[model samples]
Target: MNPDNREWERVDEKMILVMRLTGAGKSYFIQQLTGMNVSAGHELKVHILYLANFVAGTEKCQVIQTSIGNTDFAIMDTPGFDGTTRSDAEILKVITEQLSIIRLGYNLKGIVYLHRITDNRMGGSAMRSLDIFEKLVGEDALSNVVLATTMWGNVVDIAAANRRDSELREEYWGSMRRRGSTATRFDGTRESARAIVEQLLGKKAVVLKVQEELVDREMSLNQTAAGVLLELEVYAEAEQIRKRLEQLESELKYEKDSNKRLEVKRSQRRNAKAFSQCAEDKKTMKSKPGVEVKGKLKKWAESGGKIGLQALQGLAAIVSISFGIAGFILGAGF
Candidate 1:
């Protein structure tokens, strides 16, 4: 059977996207909502690198069709922005391709972005994922977004969790909340999952920014808002590494002890390797469609050849990518 024709047969069904960082309970939540026998576990394992293929049971996007209170909708399970085995660019390509397929038959009714409430602090990967998500949704579709916090049952310290929740709303999620995005909790229950889905059942389906950019405007993936944000993030990381290498060089020149000097030299070599990797990543990005290398170089030169610290102040932490599913859901893979 033709997949496109099969999708077209379900034209009346509303579409919803489930997105977040790895280990954020996306598959587990979908299992609760659709009662699918999806793979889910509490402990993140090293072998579980890719969410879409290993966890969600398919490399291509899978739409699990289910009815919620007489309303038939399809929930699309997506790969995380921080996949251990996949670059953000590769993941974005997969997502945008699937989205383009869905655009032929249906519009997105809502998006559910899950976060771990148990996390005391948001890491760099989480922050970068959130930034890219916002750009993909655009300001106009903020009302259709649900910022759902998961793993509430795992929190032993209720007060600290609440404080973290408040901090997320006030600092990280403030602008989104003010612009009509909602904050909710997922308590690892079927009822809670249904309730979250119910919130979007009545909302009017709208085209997401990515859909508009890729399908409507016919723009290349590298030219979209989310793509630009990812590029800037990569550039910022490279600049920071460059600055650190310069500092290490200065410190090595003034060091008097041989042991300290050896340590500094070791650090320099490590930083140099990392900088080389970043340069390769930039080359990959530039090779994508619609990226003009000369134009980007000109822009970099115009900005005094340095990325502003203010642009990426809190994103200095190294990303530690992991993947897992909550144990509350079914333990078998689909």
Candidate 2:
């Protein structure tokens, strides 16, 4: 658990749960929305983890107070479920515990889930996370949820992003919208974050599915739906790694090619590491008790290949040659 997590623990301030995958601007959004810097002479400030350039910046949960309209509200910032350093089980355990504690004290406005606008597709990890989120929120309170796409400034083509947004509205996130989850954009600005929060201010307060299950219903991790789903995923990963290892072993038995065997052996090693991690996670899940969840740039240097770079280079050569010839002919005529 974050040591400073409950430092600002109070009941009066209304709470909003903001979540996103790592590097999806979850912290940045919260930091901007609160408009409070670290110890800049403000009563409420968000503490951000200092990370190196290569690694994703955020690593923990921050619960802080920021006023929206005339009322002061508490915003609980969460780390991504797929974040590095901690296992998903550990992360979820800490988050659900903290949320449940807060829920007991005060009313929670709703959940706000953010996604990257530049992401071309909602991949497997994201989809699975969404499934767990649904189980966490439950069907009844899902209408209070907001599935907002963010980082609009990063995308060069607004039209392309709009098309993807429409698809999310119609197909990808269509079911969520139908169930009452509103789709919006963060626009990567403080104004956008405030606007979104304003809409949620003074809204209905509902108990999260996980909170009700664990706190009210007193359900164990295994008994809750989201917890069960995560356990199954851990088991599935282990099973998948085991099957691949068996397949590689069988292939090595019949194969005479030394190079191929070496490749398979290396693959087995990596899968072995992943399997070991998965097994440990499964153990943690069984032991712990929280039911909860959850680019196209055309530069040859970026392309790292001769195809696009060479294609552009070739096209440039052709254009140059044609222009050169035209200039010569025109000069001769003159």
Candidate 3:
């Protein structure tokens, strides 16, 4: 048999990942593609406190092997750690470790990002997850990413779905598409699911950026692209929040009315939450690997250098908010 045409069994399977937020049709999409019921897998990685300390093993990633047409695939389903059960830190750790193990054995093909077609709009948490995903995979490997949206059967408005798809292509998914990522839709049927796999069937399998960073470069969690970008965002947001807090404190000093001071105090408390989270973010990055960490984050996180954070955040807001607003304007009802 030709090496290229060989249908490797479980041990030598061509693997791809199917990633999405917790309920964004990841399970249904996989079943449609693989002809297997894989719902029983993907338990959360449990951490136990023993003797007043905590420990955990890598347990979040699940792989199932199935053949469709002439090719054999090991589909890796991820519980996209969107801070529901596990923190992003834990999620990143688990995914990197699992992929490292798989990299030694299988030909990791590409990433299948399953998004829901009926999302009303891309919610904030979903957007953040996608942002982290891009940082994990990097711009160089985007050609290996398939932005495959599912749950089309639930979407009643055909034109609306198309608009949403276009909106994603133009706005949310635009940069990835420009970098060679392909976007497609998956209806619920088995035929449709197989078709999704067919699209990536011929693409050459490649090592993901996460695998390269963690395995090849032997970089620590903070030194990795995803980790650095995450810390940068937290630091930037913290700096912004700190400015707001200072202004509020200054105003409180000048304000005379008791009611107004109380209002300022409430606002300060709310802003303090962001401060506490930022402090925790810094602490986690420093302490997780059991080393004293030091280094400034890169000036610009994207492929290019030094795009202002304000400009990036503004553009993201415009793109994200427009998805919901465009539905109404285009007569694509929610």
**Best candidate according to lDDT:** 1
The positional error of residue 148 in candidate 1, measured at the CA in angstroms, is: 0.5
lDDT of candidate model 1 versus the reference: 0.68
- Model 1, C-alpha of 121: deviation from truth (Å): 0.7
Name the candidate, 2 or 3, with the larger TM-score value. Answer: 2
The number of residue pairs in model 1 that clash at the backbone is 1
The window of 10 residues in a row where model 1 has the poorest summed lDDT is 312-321
Expressed as tens digits, the lDDT of each residue in 109-185 for candidate 3 is: 78888888888798898888888899878877799888988888888998999889898888999999999999887
Cα-based lDDT at residue 141, candidate 2: 79
Structure candidate 2, residue pairs in collision: none
Candidate 3 at 32: error in angstroms? Answer: 1.6
The segments of candidate 1 whose C-alpha lies over 4 angstroms from its true place after superposition are 1-10, 41-60, 235-334
- Residue 164 displacement (Å), model 3: 0.9
| lDDT (10s digit) by residue, model 1, range 240-268 | 99999999999999999999999999999
Model 2, position 301, has a per-residue lDDT of 24
